[model samples]
Target: MANISQLSEEERNDIVQRLKRIEGQARGVQKMVDEDRECGDILTQLASIRAAVNSLNGELLEAYLLRCIQNPDDFGSPEKAVQQAVRALVRS
Candidate 1:
């Protein structure tokens, strides 16, 4: 399996912290399963984790767009970078 790497230190830390929190949530889910906790409770936790992940992805994409693709003052450069980013993101 290929190991995906983070591109920036700040982003890496943010993601790592989020993952650690998710790990804790997973552990909690396991305990909930072991103890036969309510299905609704488990589903709620799962949904929270999914939402957190999606929010992180959105944050990273917005940051990339604003910092990398939107900063160029020259005409067409920013748009080109945006298109490239969109293609790369779609491919991934």
Candidate 2:
């Protein structure tokens, strides 16, 4: 399928920035493991990373729904586009 959603440059940059921060967190977690840090501390950092990822997922979902609303023709009708958006959310 063709790309159905197109986000602005700022939105795309925000996502890239978030991914970079997550990457750094992952490396820090690895370092903590290598240094034999407290288990609780490592788990805390892992939880943070997971939460950040979930936040990004939410932003993408919102973007998809908005795109579906904007380009209902792509899905045949507005109602169908809504259905598609609902399905996307459910799958997510």
Candidate 3:
């Protein structure tokens, strides 16, 4: 949320649209489960969802780091920022 203020409306909308697609994919997975989808097919969709979430996390992390670097005073201590970023990257 830190660097979000620097984003243009178009950038924000792009992120929102990506999230919407992910939401749709999640719903599709739910429907597939309800229909008794093949295990492999369900697992494949789950993998895709994980990849999408990872991609979004990378994008947001890039934005956050850039903002913090461009405005360090607003980000608090450098150590805390590094800790937070690393924690996010290594999280399951």
Clash count for each candidate, listed in order shown: 0, 0, 0
lDDT value for model 3 = 0.80
**Candidate 1, residues 1-92: lDDT per residue as tens digits?**
00135257777888789889888988888999999999999999999888877777777666655554545443257666667567647843
Candidate 2, lDDT over the whole model: 0.88
Candidate 2 structure quality by residue, lDDT tens digits, 1-92? 11523677888889999999999999999999999999999999999999999999898888888788888987888889989998989988
With candidate 3 superimposed using the best TM-score fit, by how many Å does residue 58's alpha carbon deviate from the native? 0.2
Better of 2 and 3 by lDDT: 2
For candidate 1, report its TM-score: 0.64
Where model 2 places Cα greater than 4 Å from the true spot, the runs are 1-5
Q: After superposition, how far is residue 40 of candidate 2 from its true place, in Å?
A: 0.3
Candidate 1: residue 5 Cα off by (Å) = 7.9
Ranking of predictions according to TM-score: 2, 3, 1
Write out the backbone clash pairs for model 3.
none
Query: What is the per-residue lDDT of model 3 for residues 1-92, given as tens digits with 9 covering 90 to 100?
Result: 27565788988998999899999999999999999999999999999998999898788877876765566556577766676666655773
Clash pairs, candidate 2, are none
Is candidate 1 or 2 superior in lDDT? 2
Better of 1 and 2 by TM-score: 2
Top lDDT model: 2
